[model samples]
Target: MFGSIWQYVYTNFLRYWLKWFIRQVTGKCELQRICSDYTPGASRTTRAENSLQASKNKVLRGALKTSRDHVEQCVDQIMKAKNIKPQKDPLFKGSLHICLLQITGYSSLYTSVEELRKEVFSSENPEHEAMLLKLWGLLMPEVKLECRITKQWGDIGFQGDDPKTDFRGMGLLGLINLVFFSENYTAEARQVLSHANHPKLGYSYAIVGINLTEMAYSLLKCGALKPHFYNTVQGTPELKHFHQLYCYLAYEFDQFWVAEQPESIMLFNQYREKFHDKVKTHLQDPDVSLTLTVGSY
Candidate 1:
């Protein structure tokens, strides 16, 4: 037992030390490697040694950003890419699958694709409540919650006076959170509005339906929403790969993670490509600024 405890402690302690070491070394302004802006694989300079120490893994910085900004940028980029009007083609049925493909490191299993459709999406499965609990653990991981086995509380998702509400998936109104909690909780992310109230966050028949009128109005303003919705999923592997990225963006919007992605020349170059002439002509654009920092977490 002592040995096990020692191993556990050693692993966590080492990881903590590793984070510090990476921050200490690369925190300097000299080597400006962007994109993979991280506190890992950092090297310390030594005079006599004439070499820098190395870290095992590297982190990419600046992954998250303000939602409003993200929405606008996404709109601009999508528009600039092409005038391709987004239509709800049957081919792209599983939009989540495409989004999930991008989310590699992040995983919220309780709401896995299967579970999402079954419990959260279709919500026919009586065990959906249990699944929601599991997903909450993965996404929020900060809110402490208790799972009551009995339906004494009535249907899953929504928790309120209305028993008529099957409340399959609540979205913004503390729906997913009816599940579990984690140590790395960012409470500000909590949504006061109900996602079940929005069609974009559609769950099941028992849940609320998205209002087409409001969605159409939103589409004109936010073009990214169309592309996001058009995705159903052509291939499994490729779609799932991107879903992770999509989900991460949907869920996590922390300032700290942004300053930690790979921002190396190569990476930035790609970003530049994505940003196009914005970097070429107006690199000094007002929006441009150094993002990575410590303790923003």
Candidate 2:
């Protein structure tokens, strides 16, 4: 009860006075101080975002929702509202512009990812069917699929004869990530598949890939990937960046699963949670860059 009251008091009352005092002492607004004090990337951008969200000024708060094309104008508006002159602080405009881009870009990236996740995989779509075939060819170059709806799908780690049913939970997002890893990191994807085919220690490759997609999606939806994207991509993050992150998860999770040598596939959830926790811990660092690095094929 007291904590809630204190938070309300702090947010509504004490915060503005504190900002006023700090600005008077330092001659810098919260945003300016944020950009100047912290170096670029997540540390600067995340703090700027938080400061904007807490601002009572409409322009400052609205800057968080500014579109990509209008980011420069939004930064101008913020400067005009705050009375920050380019002559006095030349770097502020560019720094704040980049911060706004990262902030708004995170939201935009999530929208794109969510749309893909909601797009159901359809056998009727030629593009979708082609992607599935491409994934098979990439992973299994030596063996041709006997048929589109055969047990060969199981050899690549789908749950049943047909692979389409396995995509129900994650939709097209799952398929795209699976194909992305195979397409970009062919050798690594095939190596992971080989590990998955190890009779006793083997787990379903495609199913687990989809499961890792969910893991990536969850981290993204919760804003846990902000540090990673901000640190890695200088400009706006796109869908391909998200796919690349999935590749990291897919490769790392396979290595993790093999190293542990669990009793059975039934213990997947237990180990999955452990790996999720490990990834979350890494994301807590401001310098986190979760990229998949391996030798070239």
**Best candidate, TM-score-wise?**
2
| CA-lDDT, candidates in order | 0.29, 0.94
* Model 2 spans > 4 angstroms off: 295-297
- C-alpha RMSD for every candidate: 24.4, 1.2
Model 1 per-residue lDDT tens digits across residues 43-101 = 11011011111222221111112132243343334223323223522212122122222
Worst 10 residues of 1 by lDDT: 44-53
- Candidate 2 per-residue lDDT over residues 22-109, each given as its tens digit: 9999999999999999998899999998999998899999998889999999999999999999999999999998888888999999
TM-score of the candidate numbered 2? 0.97
Residue 136 shift from truth in candidate 2, angstroms: 0.6
